[model samples]
Target: MRLQKFMAKAGIASRRKSEKIILDGRVTINNTMIKELGFKVDPKKDIIKVDNKKIFLEKEKIYIILNKPVGYITSVSDQFNRKTVIDLVSKVDQRIYPVGRLDYDTSGLLLLTNDGDLTYKMTHPSHEVNKTYIAEVKGIPNNEELKQFKEGLKIEDYITSPADINIIKKDKGKSTVKITIHEGKNRQVRKMCEKINHPVIKLKRVSFGDIRLNDLREGDYRFLTDKEIRYIKDEINEK
Candidate 1:
């Protein structure tokens, strides 16, 4: 198998991230530094090491659901000295990384796992995993604005897919709207509201695909239930 694939199977990181580890000269095969992108190695025979630590495939997989809090980055590490989701999951001995991204200011349901194939399937745009968010906007959207959101809005380079939006509450200057969309574009919910002239003041993800946040508190994480894991696996396989 390819070196990156081997690392991915070992649950160190995704194949893409493993490539970076190799490129950075952190990985070696049989005590020899190997930085080539497509290099292959047999896990049964060849010894692989990353940063001088032997790499072995994990016998068991771990999946976690975290109610991420704001001010924490979704990445494994941040160059800007900010805290990341990995920091919040330090209690977990097994390696894991966030399945997708949530902007630093956004909070709520986030998935983490050591299963690389599952991570790829979940994050891949082609899978179209639905994500739901509750957004508090600066102003109540008019009928025309709401229509535009349902029809889809253009944000710079890409035209967003049609979203399912419903007004949960409306007051003098602000309104709470629930939106469900499959595209995970950067700051997508906020950008959509901006396109409709109802800029988001606060945004929180309520659900991802079939997983709901429920009563999960911020900064807390729990292992996924067997049913939840099976459901996710089935959903990906169906796709």
Candidate 2:
């Protein structure tokens, strides 16, 4: 198998990340430092060391649904020694990586797993899986602003894809809006609201694809039920 593909199947990181690791000479194949992109290895025979630590295919796959709280980033590790979403599941025996991102301040549903194929499927823009977020913005958007959001807005150089949006609640000074979009751009919800002159005060993802946060609380997580996993596979049309 290809080196990056082997590393990805071993749950070390995504295929692209693994390629970078190989290119950086962090990976060694059979005691030789290999920076070759097309390097192939026999997983059952070749010894692979990343940063001098061995990595191999895991026997069991693990999946987790986490109710991520504010202040945690969605990465395997933080370079600044700050907390990452992976830290929240330290008790879990299996190594995993976040399927997508939720930003440092946004709080809500996040998925972690060792199934790299599923991770790639969910995170790929081509899949276009809708992610739903509820944001408390500065003020209620008038019909015009809402129309701009639904039709798509130009944030920076990139224009956003059309979003499914609606008002969930409204008060004198603040309004809660639910927006669903298929793209996973960085802080896309916050940027969208800001463009409409209703910057987000608070944001929380309520759902991803068919999986709902349900009653999960902040800083807590649970194993995905069989039914829920089945539903997610169906949504992504996973074989």
Candidate 3:
């Protein structure tokens, strides 16, 4: 099998991240550093080490949901002196990483897991897992602007896919809007509102796929219920 896929199957990291490790020259096969992207090895026959530590695929999987707060990055490590999601999930015994990214300034529901295949399935754009967010904007959005968002808007080089937008509450100057989209592009929600001239002031992701944050507080996390896990697994399988 491909080296990256092997590492992902072992639960060390996602396939993309495993490729990064290989490119960084941290991964070695039989004591020889291998930096090639296309390198392959049999999990049963080859000795793999990442950063000089013996690596093995995990036999058990863990999934978790976190109510991520602002000021934390979605990365496993950061070089810019910023806090990462992993720091807040120290209570989890096994090492895990965020399934997808949430910007440093954005807060809300985020999923973390050691299950690479599930991570790939959920984060991959083809699965179209819906993510719901409540965004508080600086000014109220007009019908035309809302319609534009629902129909889709051009932001920079590409036009966004049609998104679900509902006016939850409209006040004197500002409004609370619920927006749902399946794409996980960088700063997507913020950019979408920017396209409608209603830049977001506060954004909170309330749901991802079938999971909801409910009353989970910032920095708090919980394990996925057996039924929830099974439902997600089945959903992925069906796709």
Candidate 4:
């Protein structure tokens, strides 16, 4: 297999990230530094090392759902040594990467897995899987603002795709609203709310596609049920 694909399969990183790793000459095969994206290696015979540490393809695929809390970044490791989602699942034996991202301040359902194919499929914009988030914003959106939000609001360069939002509660100066969108742009929910003149005070993802956070408490994680795994794989297969 291609070097980047092999690295991704080894749970080192995503394919795109693996390519950058290769280009940066951080990967080696049999003691020889390889910077070629198309370099091939036999998984069974080739000794692959990333950052000088040998890596092997994980035989057991692990899928975990984490109720990521605020202050934890969604990454394997942070350059600044800040805590990461991986730190919450330190007991997990296999190396896994997060499927998508939630901003540093956003808390909620986040999937971590070694299944590279599923990760790529889920994160790809073409798939357009719905992600539902509950956000507390500055103020209640007026009818016109709500209409603009649903119709698609221009934020920065691109207009957001049509989204669904419903008022869940009305507080004294803030409103709790549920927003669902298929796109996973960086802080998209916050940006969308801000565009409607109701910047988010707090955000928490409730669900992604069919996977719900349920009653999972913050900072806790659980392995995905077999049925949940099969359902997601079947959904990706269908497309």
Candidate 5:
């Protein structure tokens, strides 16, 4: 396999991050520093190390979902020593990573796993996986603003893809919305709302594909059921 795949299989990092690790001059094979993306290795014959620490493939894979709370970044470690999603799953012994990212203030269904291939598939733009969020915005959007959401709006450099937006409730000063999107741009839901002049006050991802956040509470987590795993696999395999 390629060097990145080898590193991912060893549980060092995802293939993309492993490529960066290789290019950063942190990875070595057979006592020689290598920085080529095309480099391949024989797991049985090659000795691999990252920063001189030997790494071996994990025998067991773990899949978990967490109802992420506010303030924790979706990372393994923080340079500023702040909390991370990993801190929430300290009880889980295996090395796992967030499948995709949610903003620090964003809450709800976040999946963690050691299955790097599955992670790749989930994050790939080609997959076009859908994620749903419950958003509370500053004010109720009129039909024109709602049409802009369904039709897509300009964010930074580009316009967003058309989204599925449903009004769940509209009160005096705010409204609750059910918004579904395919692209996972940084702070996208909030940004989209802001573009429409509604600006999200609170956001929570309620679903990814068919997986719902359901009754999971803030800062709580649970392993995925076998059937749920099958559902994910089936969703990805769809033609």
Candidate 6:
């Protein structure tokens, strides 16, 4: 297989990212640094190394869901040494990575896995997987604001796609709302609330597609059930 594909299969990263790793001159085969994207190797006989560490194709694919708590970044490592989702799953022996990402201040269901193909499909914009977030905003939005939110809002340079927004509760100066979005743009939910003049006080993702966060406690994680795995694969396949 191609070098990048091999690296992705070894649970190093997604195929696109593996290409960058190769171009960055971080990969080597049999002690020879390789920068070619099309470089192929026989997994059984060739010795592959990324950043000087030998890597082999992972035989077991592990999938996990974490009830991510606030203050933890969704990454394998932190340059500033802050907590990351990987720290929460230190006991898991296999090399796994977050499927996508969640902001440091945002909390809730986060998927981590070594299944590179699934990760690639789920993160791709073409899949358009729906993700639901429960957000607490500074104020209750008026009917017009709600309408604009559902229809789409101009934020920065690009306009957001149509989303589903519902008022879950309104008390005092704050309101709890449910927002479901198909695109996973950075800080999209927070920016959308801000555009409506109701900045988010807190945000938590409750579900992605049909996989609900349910009653999972904060900072805890569990392996995905077989049915859940099947559902995810089927969801992507259908798209």
All models: lDDT?
Answer: 0.90, 0.90, 0.89, 0.91, 0.89, 0.94
Clashing pairs in 6: none
Off by more than 4 A, model 5: none
Model 4 root mean square deviation, Cα atoms = 1.0
Find the 10 residues in a row with the least total lDDT in model 2.
230-239
lDDT of 1 by residue, 92-143 (tens): 9888888988999999999999898788778877898889999999888888
Question: Per-candidate TM vs. native?
Answer: 0.94, 0.96, 0.96, 0.97, 0.97, 0.97
**Model 2 lDDT per residue over 64-166, tens place:** 9999999998999988999999989999998899998998999999999897767767776778888999899998899999999999999999999999889
On a 0 to 100 scale, what is the lDDT of residue 36 in model 1? 100
- Better candidate number, 1 or 3, judged by TM-score: 3
All models, RMSD in angstroms = 1.5, 1.4, 1.3, 1.0, 1.1, 1.0
Candidate achieving higher lDDT, 4 or 5 = 4
Error of 1 at 136 (Å): 0.6
lDDT of 3 by residue, 1-239 (tens): 88888788777788888889999999999999999997979888999999898878877788899999999999888999789999999987777888888999999999899898888887777788889999999798889998999888888888889899998998878899999998889999999999899999999999987889999999999999998899888878888
Backbone clash pairs for candidate 4 read none
Off by over 4 Å in 2: none
Indicate the TM-score of model 6: 0.97
lDDT of 2 at 90: 95
For each predicted model, how many residue pairs clash, with residues at least 3 apart or on different chains? Answer: 0, 0, 1, 0, 0, 0
Sum up the clashes in candidate 2: 0
Error of 5 at 17 (Å): 1.4
TM-score of structure candidate 1: 0.94
lDDT of 3: 0.89
